[model samples]
Target chain A: MTTADARESTPSSKAPRTERGRKTLRKLLDAAAIEFGEKGFHEASITGITRRAGTALGSFYTYFDSKDEIFRALVDDLSGKVREAARDALQSELPALETERAALAGFLSFAREHKEIYRIIDECEFVDPQSFRHHYETTARRIHERLEEGMNRGELREGLGEAHAWAIMGMNVFLGLRYAVWSEEAAPEEVAELANSILRDGIAPRSSNKG
Target chain B: MTTADARESTPSSKAPRTERGRKTLRKLLDAAAIEFGEKGFHEASITGITRRAGTALGSFYTYFDSKDEIFRALVDDLSGKVREAARDALQSELPALETERAALAGFLSFAREHKEIYRIIDECEFVDPQSFRHHYETTARRIHERLEEGMNRGELREGLGEAHAWAIMGMNVFLGLRYAVWSEEAAPEEVAELANSILRDGIAPRSSNKG
Candidate 1:
């Protein structure tokens, strides 16, 4: 499915089941990401988000209780999507390296499609420490599970059980933030290549390893 | 000399010819680091910084045209200090590996003292593209230079050169942010140990590399 279609496919039975409700919800989320990402959490208001979404002020309360609730939902939803994408890539029949490449590619694709959402999530760590910690640790553990699976299957270099997994995940996030999200010129593919090369070989000289 | 003493001994003239001018500049920088580090560049205000430094609002303008300029000064100054610290450690009468270890230790010490400043620099890349690019490339080149020096002196494994430098720098920064800045429970020394071990020995199974 196209990215927009994928993003729009959210659970709706909890909210109004009408078509208008779904469209309003989608618009609200889009506008909220932009507003929240740009202005930060404390500065963002539900009224501003609703106005930007072109919905009536009262309509906002139908979907969310407060601006904080909207932000919480937005982050939780995006985090879920990112985890699902990573898990799916891991399950695919790519080699270990290719799987990693695809997983990063998937993440970069997600960031590209939802740049504002990614920024909101990235800044959330600083904006809301408790919530960000809960989300970050959970995501780290999930990524670690994937790495452990690769190690158990002898698909990746052995002895790199958990720490290495954390390192790789953290390193990728750092790179994505600096090069892909913040950078204007560098393409995702180039960043991927650089990261992949560093991951596989490390900074040590090949000859030094033999010595 | 103690860290404080060393900072004091560095002639105030090192920054500005006038002692009063230098002190004012230092207050602005100190205030900027705290405000920017805590609230980020966009969120930090000149008024807040001046208040924190106990300087008149007009005096703030006399030193800095805008908050961005203050931020730029802080970043440039921090970057220079980090580089100079690294260089000083490397030049000491230590072996290659020892030199590297010392440099890492110096970095950890700096991180401990200026945790907020480190966060500001890391987040600054998201604030302005040109500023980030200039700092990132200069830092990268400095790292490459250190690695080259170590390799030539037979301190590091051969053939990696600039690539190795980049990976080491990337890994260290990622680890520092994750273990040090993100969570205070992690001591710099402990993170340094884990990282140093990983650097000395690859994550691959020990048996596989028994050449």
Candidate 2:
């Protein structure tokens, strides 16, 4: 098909009910996420996304201005879910070590369940550079806040609260990229354990944070 | 031009034994890096790379196999230079802190100088997932070795050596992605400070560690 033909399929049917609109939008987004995840954003066509969703090309335009816009909406949707999952994961009354594990597990689980969304968000830099940074900074900030709460509760060590939080967040993201995106050999539990061991115990010799 | 045309232009020439070949390859890689960085692997084409490089189509294939191969070679080439630069940065009997800072600075400087490479490696999963992981793990292994050496010399904290090394490497990589790739406002030096703060003082509280 011509590029434009592939770019334009059928349009979404307009509905008066907000719920119907929401459902349509969700379907379109979900399809877009899968397509973007598989093909990369630039390679994905609007026609492909709509066809997958059983919608029209114009319908997608009704929801998003362009492929880039759809990609952004997808990232935002998934990021919100990840944030919520992280929050829920932190709700336990476990000690520092356990808390750390739970948080990592929470993130891993979120990544595992929403594989398409995960891929789309992780590779957002290719689709749109600015949005990637915005989302990354926002997520980092959320993780920092969580760690700050842990610090106040005497859960984390003193010297580098925010710094550690950032490092931990970075570790989690990289590890998730590995376990979720790259390899299927390492089970989620295994990945979580390795991450936890490295984070809580650290790489220092005989240096458990017995404090 | 077609996608194949876009990738073939810049990758054909051999490593410049002569100044002309050298200049041509340099120009081609530079141009390709920008295109690859902005458009990503799949979306970027041989024609685009060549056009930017101001080189011939046949010349592009002479230097590299395919676009995929060119990307792989690009990653390999960049990693070697980065490792060399990091090693050179530590050229001294300076105290632990100075050495660490110098090494970090050197790495950051290299990252700033090669922003396109940074984007390629970081966002490469979209193009070739396997190659990205392979390159990343290889780079991680090298960074680990450096940190291991530092620990042996008492240049860095002992214990959990590999883990700490990984964290440090992750820190540098993520920061580079943020400051150099995703971010427009944050300077590389400033990002380095954020990392430096972590190395000097870890995130866990001193009290917890002591205990």
lDDT of 1 by residue, B65-170 (tens): 7777777677776766676766666675776556556666667667767788556765665665465566656666776776677678776666554334545666
* Candidate 1: fraction of native contacts reproduced: 0.20
lDDT of 1 by residue, A1-211 (tens): 1133223223343465789887887788778888887787778888889889999988887887777767866776677777766666667687666667678767766676666765677566666655566666666677677667767777556655444565666656655655556653556666666566555544455566566
> Chain A TM-scores, one per candidate?
0.81, 0.81
What does the lDDT read for residue A27 in candidate 1?
A: 86
Instruction: Give the alpha carbon lDDT tens digit for every residue of A1-211 in model 2.
Output: 0112212222333321477777888799778878887887668988989999998887777777788777776776666667677767879687765776787778877787676765687677666666676777777776677666767887765544444555677777776766675555566666667667655544443343342
Most accurate candidate by lDDT: 2
How good is the docking of model 2, by CAPRI class? acceptable
Show model 1 residue runs off by greater than 4 Å.
A1-24, A35-57, A93-98, A154-163, A182-190, B1-15, B35-62, B93-103, B122-133, B147-170, B184-186, B196-201
TM-score of 1: 0.74
Candidate 2 chain B least-lDDT 10 residues: B1-10
Looking at model 1, the pairs that clash are: none
